[model samples]
Target: MSMSYIDKNYIYAVSRIRYAELRLLDGSVFDRLIEAKDVAECITILAEKGFGGEYRDPEGMLGYEKSRLWELIAELVPDMSVFDVFRLQNDYSNLKAAIKESALDLDIPGIYSQEAVADPMLIKQAVRERRYKELPLEMADIAELCHELFLRTGDGQLCDIMIDRAAMEAILRAAEASKEPVLIEYSRLTVGASDIKIAVRAMLTGKDDEFLRRALAPCPLLDTELLIRAALSGMDELCAYLMNTDFKDAVTELRKSLAAFEKYCDDLIIERLGTQKWNSFGLGPIAAYILARETEIRSVRILLTAKQNGFSAESIRERMRRTYV
Candidate 1:
């Protein structure tokens, strides 16, 4: 779990990942899904690809794929903690949902993700009982803070932002501590992109400086203070700032819409993951495979949603996230 992922120990794991990567859904498979007459047909096509394997609903099949992906990685690695960077967001999401449920005195198990390191039930109980110690260290204080903040201010939006920032912060710390270059870059992209999203949303929603400051998480890839200044001014200022950074390409998507910008961000992450496929050793390929599967699962979910909702294939084809395959 230390920063020693680039050695012989990972060779076999990388080999397994290499084979696993081959099974990742390519464009042709996605095409089949899109062309399928209905959601059931899509699952049938998925089965042909070894994904729609179990006879479950679309959501259940996707859940099975995600669980199967994680199980494969855990089987290959000696320590799973190094992979915490990938799971942190889900943990925080569960925390956020738990806090909301606590405030409302409600229980909604469906809101919790199964992919997180933290158990959803534990988080629900911790928040409901006001027992912060029951949560992870990175989440404990923030959980308590958001739990009480919602009760005090009745501002669910504020609580959401705080929890999100906390999630970004925790993820960055985990990535940097791992000392994996790909992991580090992945973390930076996540944090920086998230910051831009917050900034853009602030500009679009008339959020004040206090909200922007509270929402943005620090990323070494960009100047945080400058981002705040630009966001406070307007979209032009924000786009101008983004144009000068490594994320200059994001400027066009930023101009389009938040959804387009988000899709661009996801595709960029996949572009980063692309390099891992050529790697024959170390954790990069395994890590990349994890993300690749995530992208694949997410895209499949999107496609299924489009099918269920009668969304046009053209609309989805334009925004479907790039796959690692």
Candidate 2:
């Protein structure tokens, strides 16, 4: 929220981030995690490395790590609002959870995110009390609509897609408002990736145009109309259209599976943000650090879940994302 947000050189922040980058989970730590005999050993390894904060269980430990991440970022930055691109999704996610919770009148454990701009508990209250004004402006109307839609029709999928599309649009607005290259690129990539996933999924499932149009959020990088047509026409057409955009590479992964394509999308962002390590000024490095840490957390979650499910190391490795380090 400064007059010129990135005018001040973040020398100390960049240096500290560089130092912290060394501690990011790398291949070796991941190897130990993958090879761990059980979840207990994995927890012990993560705890020894300064994770699992105050609890040994995965959910509590991961929640602690997430809270600690935001706390650390708040201490390092002048205005945390510049990082709304990362936090806004949590708000939308909470909105989704709150809508469902209110409609069902049930409290689902571990359903909401921690440390979002809006309190998750407050969102639940607003929806339950029918006080839309209590929610953030971006979410107020959508919360009302989604809550009613779910209540009236009991169509969870429909409500979910509506909220998902809204969340992507919210991310785009926040990214542009920040006027940061890293945020903007991440936002566009998110929309582009998500829209393609919708189209590909729709195509395979033989979804109609109305459903596709409703599900696809607008993006400057991809033509929503053309993508919709391609998806409706056939998978071949969808793959051909994808080949022309920057997301052409994603087509190959889409052929392999949705999970593979998701990993590709993630690695693509990390590849771009990877260059930010050399940046010593402005918000890019700090933003990249946030992203790197989030990716680390996500990767850990994936690996540990796979281990608990008895997945082979090779299968887990294929799903693991590229680290920032």
Candidate 3:
């Protein structure tokens, strides 16, 4: 096969990812996990599948699996910054955790996610010590602003909203700066879906238009102005507005339930990323592989939790996301 520069660059990485994809948990694996009599049985099945070796605790096993995913990706991609769009949310999440922990003087364990490019502990230290210069420029400013907002108003929700909006904007900026079509599309879909979710929640809670406007981030795929207005009007108006946009198909899922809508959004992204399997070039395949693995891990976690709780198989299946394999 004739290979272009992009193809040649990612040839080895894609080949390795092909092998990695084979081990991804599919629907059958989830079925078994769901049917497992107890958490121990579920852990055994996961161990047999090489998910998290010897970690009996479900949370421990899941955490191990997440860390392993990032470790593998780090080994494959030399310049990890290429995937910053995926990791930026974790950074913001850590910032949120740190800011709240500092304000409340609470040592909240397991609140920080390890799937970020920046060290979570460093971010926590920077926030705790008010050392803004120690963090990245964008993050430093956001941390300071969120800290001040939380301190002044004692409104955790407002602080969270500000951080979430900033995170989405950062993801959008990273996607645009990369100039990768797949990354840009992924970012747009993520941000647009997030905006929709925020609007829906705000509408349901009877939040004012000003709150919605502040919470929703700008995205190329959806008109933010129209979205805020629709949200202010009600669910019907919001659905009607969505029908006219690129997210027309999501209307059905939105009607079903919020969980259903979330699944639909994730499935849409997975379907788009699945196309990268046939392409032999660039960062798309790598990005797809990472996302697919993350999705599979999430599905496994859900099944494990449901099984541990003795939930019905049908109920677990309903919440299961689309498998990439």
Backbone clashes, each candidate: 1, 0, 0
Instruction: Show model 3 residue runs off by greater than 4 Å.
Output: 1-8
TM-score ranking, high to low: 1, 3, 2
Q: Please report, as a residue range, the 10-residue window in candidate 1 with the lowest summed lDDT.
A: 1-10
Mind giving the per-residue lDDT tens digits that candidate 3 earns over 1-325? 3344433367788888888889888878887877777778888888999888668788888888888888888888777887999999999999999999999999989899888879999999999999988987789898998898897888999999999999999999998988878888889999999999999999999999889888999999899999999999988999999999878999999988888999898889899888998878788888888888888878878887788778987898899889888
The stretch of ten residues in a row with the least summed lDDT in candidate 2 is 1-10
Q: Which stretches of candidate 1 lie over 4 Å from their true place?
A: 1-8
lDDT agreement with native, every candidate:
0.88, 0.88, 0.88
lDDT of 1 at 285: 86
Error of 2 at 235 (Å): 1.8
| Cα-based TM-score, every candidate | 0.95, 0.94, 0.95
What is the C-alpha local distance difference test score of candidate 3? Answer: 0.88
